[model samples]
Target: MKYTRILTVGALMASLAACSAGPAGKAELCESFDQLGTQLLSGNGIGNPLFRAADSLGDVAERYSAQNLGSDAKSLHAIADSDGTDSNELRNATMNIAKICGHPLGLG
Candidate 1:
């Protein structure tokens, strides 16, 4: 089911990309990415929040992947791309992202 969701998101993003064909489309995509991140951070409850976070993470990843930002997807892709996975930078970045999104991961 998780895999399916990922595929679906990827497909959806691709379709969106096709429809949006200029600077305006890029701005809209970027806004959607930011909004999704915000939604992830604002999740309430305990376990439910984690699940929502996971889902939002996936969606954000898809958006970032669509952006084709390479290793510079900022805080979120730092860990995934393993550019700072072994250092405190990754942890700090992760925490900052969570905090910026209005969710504190408390892993720092």
Candidate 2:
């Protein structure tokens, strides 16, 4: 499933490379990314933690369209659309976004 998810996201990224507009910068992405990370770590008992995190990522991914970060955004969309994605999938996506933003998030 992990490999499948990566392959799927990779395909989406290839398509997103054509975009030239993205978020103002990675800092903008980290703002939303950090908030979602906080929520995920809080164990606040949100019904769909992965989806919530993914939704936040999708919003940031829009800004990175030119950088081919759409995979993160698209993966987030897939997660938000369904409630069955495993934590590993979301975790990988989170890590990828964090690396791009140069922010190390505590996503316990």
Candidate 3:
């Protein structure tokens, strides 16, 4: 009986871990967006590259949302593609998504 109880508890813990294992939540997405925006605002140039990279991140976030990966697609995309100057911010944000979603980008 004790062994059975232990096994059940172990199973429950495993299930909970599995449930919690994937993706950033909406709050995290919002925070990342804000950080990216701040970076963009502090940089220079036309800002088109930043926006383009952000758009790509937004696309991935939307796909994740469709798969129920814990982000709000509309909100994340809106925040991500918002105005900014820092190219790194956009790149980092997209890279973060790629890391989380297990999608790697290759530069040709």
Candidate 4:
């Protein structure tokens, strides 16, 4: 019973710590999403940086949707997945992401 109590207390403390380390703030999340979008849009081809941008956008998309940019985030992912051979798609997606993030990177 004592060990069980100690375990429960430890679990509670861990959960509290996790709760304190919450998600990034709205401005930060939006800026990160915009930055990744810019990188993907500027990429010359489907390379490491492009793939990294896509991967990062996956996380950004989740946070963006939480902040009510669900349609833009989904569109961003779709463009990322489909724009391997066409920068125009990426450019359009970047514009949408920038508009949603309110931090345009001047892709147009």
- Report, for every candidate in turn, its global Cα lDDT versus the true structure: 0.43, 0.68, 0.49, 0.59
Residue 27 displacement in candidate 1 (angstroms): 19
**Estimated TM-score for each candidate:** 0.27, 0.59, 0.31, 0.49
Tell me which of candidates 2 and 3 scores higher on lDDT.
2
- Cα deviation at 62, candidate 3, in Å, is 1.6
Residue range 5-100, candidate 1, lDDT tens digits: 999999999999776433333344344345534544454445444333333343443444234432223554434444223224433444434433
After superposing candidate 3 on the true structure, give the runs of residues whose Cα lies further than 4 Å from its correct spot.
Answer: 1-47, 65-72, 85-108
Query: Of the candidates numbered 2 and 4, which has the greater lDDT value?
Result: 2
On TM-score, the stronger of 2 and 3 is: 2
What overall lDDT, based on C-alpha atoms, would model 2 receive against the true structure?
0.68
Better of 2 and 4 by TM-score: 2
lDDT of 1 at 24: 32
Q: Which candidate number would show the highest TM-score if scored against the true structure?
A: 2
Residue 57 miss distance in model 3 (angstroms): 1.4
RMSD of each: 10.1, 12.3, 13.3, 6.0
lDDT tens digits by residue: candidate 3, 26-74 = 5554444454455455543464544554554464455443244334344
